[model samples]
Target: MAVTLTEAAARHVARYLGRRGKGVGVRLGVKTTGCSGLAYKLEYADEAAPEDVVFEEHGVKVLVDPKSLPYLDGTQLDFVREGLNEGFKFHNPREKDRCGCGESFRV
Candidate 1:
């Protein structure tokens, strides 16, 4: 029933917010798409909805909508560096399978 960001992720998000000068937090959600049927959606939230579930970790806020809560509960967002490529990765405990391309997941 909660989502969190890794220390690296929090730092990465904080740096971007610092540069942008405005943003309440990051919003995490799910969308139906890709080979596995669901893909992760992320965006910088300028404001929070009244019903948004907010989890604060490492000094960064992670927001989730009620509709998306079940699919994303207990997920941890991490910022990682692999060779020359670096990006945010999802550690979702509810995921039963991930697509071959790693763009989507099924639970």
Candidate 2:
């Protein structure tokens, strides 16, 4: 089981970390509050929890909690820019479907 970041995603995150100057890495997880039952949650992690599973790629660390690993494994994150819109996108092999609004997913 592993989670990875694309080169673009890693560079995007690394730039943000450099600007913020205090984060150890980025944390990725799931929350149950969207139309498809689960939504991705991401944030800068100043410190990792004891049970966090860490994956490092392109010099950027991605942290996943034990409880969220099953849902996130084999996922590759990418940073994208389409005209004026830009954000992190998830390539999740475990995802069975996503909501129409692109805010949530089901596995």
Candidate 3:
């Protein structure tokens, strides 16, 4: 079970961290919300919790809590640009369905 970030994502995150100047890494998790019952949660982590799992890829650290591991395992995160919009995208193999608005997922 693991989570990783693409090179582009790493660069993007690193840039953000550099600008913020106070973050150790990024945290990825799930929360109950949205039309599909679950939505992705992301935040800048200044420190790692004892129960957190960390994965380093492309020189960036990705943090995840134990409770979110099962739902996020084997997920590869990518930074993408579509027309004038750009953001992080999750490539989760365990996702069975995504809400119509693309804000949440169910597995």
Q: For each candidate, what TM-score against the reference? A: 0.97, 0.97, 0.97
> Model 3, which residues run further than 4 Å from truth?
none
Q: Look at candidate 1 and tell me the lDDT of residue 52.
A: 94
TM-score for candidate 1, please give it. Answer: 0.97
Lowest lDDT block of 10, candidate 3 = 35-44
lDDT head-to-head 1 vs 3, winner: 1
Task: Candidate 1: list runs displaced more than 4 Å.
Answer: none
Clashing residue pairs found in predicted model 2: none
Candidate 3: lDDT of 8?
Answer: 94
Model 1 lDDT per residue over 1-107, tens place: 88989999999999999999999889999999999999999999998999999999999999999999999998999999999999999999999999999999998
Name the TM-score of candidate 2.
Answer: 0.97
Off by over 4 Å in 2: none
